[model samples]
Target: MEGKDTDQIPLLIPYKLGQIRLSHRIVLAPLTRFRSYNSIPQSHAILYYSQRTTKGGFLIAEAACISRAAQGFKNTPGIWSKEHIDAWKPIVDAVHAKGGIFFCQLWHPGRVSDQSFEPNVGQAPVSSSDKQCSPLVDGGVEFKFLTPRKLNSDEIRPIVDDYRMAARNAIEAGFDGVEIHGAHGYLIDQFLKDQVNDRTDDYGGSLENRCRFALEVVETIANEIGPDKVGIRLSPFSNYMDAGDSNPEALGIYLAKSLNKYGILYCHVVEPRMEVMEERTECVVSLGPMRRAFNGTFIAAGGYEREDGNNAITEGRADLVAYGRLFLANPDLPRRFELDAELNKHNRDTFYSPDPVVGYTDYPFLETII
Candidate 1:
């Protein structure tokens, strides 16, 4: 009897989200770049994306604040303005020209902001309560701990409407879909996590109440841009942006069941872990619970490698894999993976610098022309 061909490699297959069939499972994760031109995605952004396009792949654009108050960072993009929507059209067009699908991640920082980023002049950041988000204050010149003002019933309605408007704006900007930035302890996550939400109103005090805000945003966005074009990101136990849930498991169950009502395309779940291990195992490791909760196509992200990514699909834990830092270092990451070429290491120093030419477009790729 011939020796068993143990080397039969499992074919790395493509995944689908509703009608959108991806040629590969590699997804470009939503990464924040403070390189927006005048708080709007610029021509450089179009060039930046054009360089990173992969055949049959999808790119989740960096978080764009849904409203003025949603902006906490110095130079992040926003979808609330006409200029922002107009500016993003070319970028979306460029991505489509390369046969790639793009989705803009809509976000609002809420309490995770400073006075400089406030909407109303000199107003404090808003949240579910008066709790301070940051645990540290470097200094007045650098950074300081900020206590957020509570959002009253009157203000909550318009804030929820902002998401609906942002969704409409995303469609105007020529995006394939919109992903709600409900992760990383931002506004929606802040409302979801009990630690930050101390409200006695209908929006808080209980798990269901705490989730009310996020659910509203989801429903509103779905209604504005059709359910098939809407998706969300959720990190049940992420400590990065000070988001914490009393019971992550219960939160996942509740969120999953609630989100399913919208008929959205996918629920992107970030796998929480410590080590910088391979992507496949690390991605799915935290998803066993989410997979049980969410019945739709699931996109798993955070520190994934090719092998670990393929395992996620083969194991049925994830429908797609979102790659972050890897895409930054290798513009042709999907091609590099197909060829099994060595990847370029990313420079940590220039990760967030103002200099446009350095980390933004300096990475090289295989010489296909040669």
Candidate 2:
């Protein structure tokens, strides 16, 4: 995929995070395509992710639900079924064949969900408390309120077990590791945010208590499949889904410290966003505090381009960088960086639709004439 101008581009470098040695610092972040609307991913879904694999790069698979009740957006994939695991096997195997590492990002969307997308027999999304999410109905429908069921002390144990089962499924599917989706104002982030979590139990009041569920899930996943094969993603202070923790600094520090104790692979954080007209402006937050808290590797995502990714590594703020939409538009993203090639613009219309081969995996890699 290298271009004629590749010689002018800075030399791409290799880096190491714990036991995982990356040939390049670039990583493909989890971007939700929603093409796999059904609970099970099809063979085409396998081809989509497999096509993006490059030598020693990392692929964090799009958010796969931990359970049926956790399904949120239409067409999103899940790991709750045997068919799901079977469907993903070829994708992970293909990445391995290319000498790349793949991680299935496990998630539960929680109250950020609609009843229309609920699983066949599951209840409305469950969260740390019974709270209604800011309704932004996906398909141009009139917005409706979602009163999610709250998990009690007894009920919490099973959901935690679901995470463990999902982790086991990831390994069975041939993934190198598993990434817990604790970011983007989803289930785990809902638990961390005081505005969403209002219960009086240990999982509600203080910052430590608010992070209890996340800690439990991380610890459980690490225990299930060695800490080296587990990682967690978090959006500390962003309101991507109307989520904000009472004390972001404290929450970040505490969670980072707890994760370090597990000796997991890394912690991926989404940088803060500022609204600018119709679009949002992304800025890098100081990673100094979090770097101190987590002794393991750290990755930064959200609006990071090649130069920014390089800068983040140069500044010692991040060990690696994750690209979401950029990777969507440019499948050979690392090569694009290596050659300083102009990227293909993403078609926003096809981002979430169910049509196959449109936005799913149509991006062609750049080829050069020797």
**Candidate 1 TM-score to native:** 0.90
Candidate 2 per-residue lDDT, tens place, 1-370, comes to: 3445433333256768678887777888898777775767767776677778888888899899888777776678899878889888887887788888899999888778865665644466678778777766442343344778888778887989999999999899888899999987788998898878887988889887888999999999999999999989997867766788767777788889888888999999877663312266654556568877888889887777788777777778888888877788788888778866788877766777777798768877777311
Give the clashing pairs for model 2: 36-75, 37-75
lDDT of 1: 0.80
TM-score of each: 0.90, 0.92
After superposition, the stretches of candidate 1 with alpha carbons farther than 4 Å from their true spots are 1-12, 114-120, 135-145, 274-285, 368-370
Number of the top candidate by TM-score? 2
Question: What lDDT score goes with residue 314 in model 1?
Answer: 81
Clashes of each: 3, 2
For every candidate structure, what is the RMSD over all alpha carbons to the true structure, in angstroms?
4.7, 2.8
- Error at 111, model 1, angstroms: 1.0
